[model samples]
Target: MITPAPNVPAIASTPTFTDTEIKPSQTIAANTTTPPTISETLTLPPVSVIATEVPPVKSTPKLANIEWLTKFRGIPGIGVNPVDAWLNETGTTSDPTCRDTRSPSCDKHYRDPLVDNWAAIRLTEVKIVFYKDELEKLITFSGVGSSISNWFHINRVLASSWTTLVGRTYGYFSLEGDAGNGQRFFTASPYQGCTKDRIFTLVITKQVASCAFDRHSSYPQFLFVTGDGWGYPENMTGIALADSFAILIK
Candidate 1:
């Protein structure tokens, strides 16, 4: 037998794996590339509300000459009397008649109705303001505080009953105090709003003798005159539309 060289091939053939030689797959390779980062944006809506209105608060203001004073609305229907025509050249308007001619009551040491009932209680301050052409002129008791002791005004007749000086008649003002305490009276310069060439002024009285006047004897506490087409208790010519007065009780 030739033995064919025992069949030893010139080159040995490499061994190949059969189906039995293979094992099941084990580890899995992870993906390396990161996913492209995604960028996101958000949005929203709006809202609203409501409210009410309120008035302004004002403090007591200081008074000054030609200073901007506040508008004062005094007791309405009160008339401002024209003082110029009533008072004579000597500043004498009232006489012994004491009723018709009672411009400045020529009595001293008069009894105050407020003082008689309440001894310590007296009007501590008084404020007077005149309005014309939408402008204000203010005067206070403190302005003329010095010479006043117990000063007040009185009306002799009803405003409607007074035939003379229909719109210019303001009742009498009594200024009773020690001799020359201070500026006893004030004069309001003439303004061209009234019926006549009337210069307005404040009325104050002086003590001539011991003559004392009691307020209980009078019927009307004050008089009102009609001016600028208004009357007392009903007419507010200067007072309602223009003028005003106020008082501070201490």
Candidate 2:
């Protein structure tokens, strides 16, 4: 066995290595280029502000005082056509009895009172006379009462109503004289000729102080006539009278 071992190769042994020293990480400079400074500004379109001014609203004026001049007795007063006045008063145009266009006058009757009841009268008839142009030239109010006292009361009431309507006062000047202080008189006659009728007259002028001289000069006049007896034989005292009041505008 010893002669055979002399011709065999030798076996290699495991190698042992010694520990090496640890080294710290080294710092390296970075070559970084700051991105080219790209500054961009945004341009905006010009803004326009428009101011619109609103107009102020206009206010209407008040007409409380002079409103009655245009409207009275639930109808329009003088200068209006009789047909139109009738239509307005009755709210009808089909009433043939009220007016006839062929005639120069229109007659209307009222069964009820048109004014305050305490005034002791009722408007029974209204006769409107027109010119060729169909405009009213004269309007007459015919009323009948139970006694003479009622007649007098109604006359006084009509005078008061006129005073309120025209905003004037009664004066005491003669018919030939001037109406001083812008006031005029109401002329009344208890006996007018053989007719034995009571009559009342008032003349209104455009100028307040010129009534007497301006009576027939295109001014409006009011005349009232009333009586019970036809002739001189009958007694007129304490009797019912037919009152006819007329408004004349020339």
Candidate 3:
């Protein structure tokens, strides 16, 4: 330390630094070890690929023809809804095999009388009622040779009433609206042409029968197919005839 003169500030000593030597925490040896080489090559079996063939498309019915009448309305502890009333005591039979005392009564048989069936029956008035929300449609009617049949021409659709006819009625009539505008109608047929073996579907929507009723009508009605001398040949060979019908709403 040096002495300071009077009224002069003493100088402070500063620390000096030089280059320092640094060493690693531990010395590592060079890796002289080598992985063992694969002495022999492995062989794999050859694989064979097979091509798959696709089958041809076949025709089938368009609608969901359920066995509704037998399973619901006429069964034990079951009956038609209050809104539904049968105008004809005998319902039409598209296929006689499905006909039984348990089936709804109608007056027409799509089955030919010569082909072992009951007499052709006729119907007049009918009523189908349901809650407005419960109707998503898909209601279906069955018949033979009706695959290509004009569903809308079966008969005139009307409003809910006591004298409603519900069966094959031959005539051209108009409903209040088209499709979903106010009313809608849909029909489907099997992929195959109408023979004794083929079945067709007839659908009626919850549209307003504005002829006698208003657009706010809750029930839609149908008439019977009274016109005759139409449809497929009554007699055929090995037709495997089977006619059935069902309707679903809810």
TM-score pick, better of 2 and 3:
2
Tens digits of per-residue lDDT for model 2 on 79-175?
A: 2222222223443233333233333323332212223242353333322222223322322333344221122222333222123222223222122
Instruction: Give the per-residue lDDT of model 3 (tens digit) for 71-143.
Output: 1111111222111222122233345443443355433322222212212221222212211122211223223
User: Which model scores highest in TM-score?
Assistant: 1
- Between candidates 1 and 3, the lDDT winner: 1
What TM-scores do the predictions have? 0.21, 0.20, 0.18
lDDT to native, each model: 0.29, 0.28, 0.26
Clashing residue pairs in candidate 2 (N, C-alpha, C atoms within 3 angstroms): none
Model 1 poorest 10 in a row by lDDT: 212-221
Candidate 1 residue-wise lDDT at 23:
29
What residue runs in model 3 are displaced by over 4 Å at the alpha carbon? 1-12, 17-230, 236-240
Q: What is the model-wide C-alpha lDDT for candidate 1?
A: 0.29
**Deviation in angstroms for 144 in model 3?**
26
In candidate 1, which residue ranges exceed 4 Å CA deviation?
Answer: 1-74, 78-118, 131-135, 142-198, 201-243
Question: Which ten contiguous residues of candidate 3 have the minimum total lDDT?
Answer: 74-83
- Backbone clashes, each candidate: 6, 0, 20
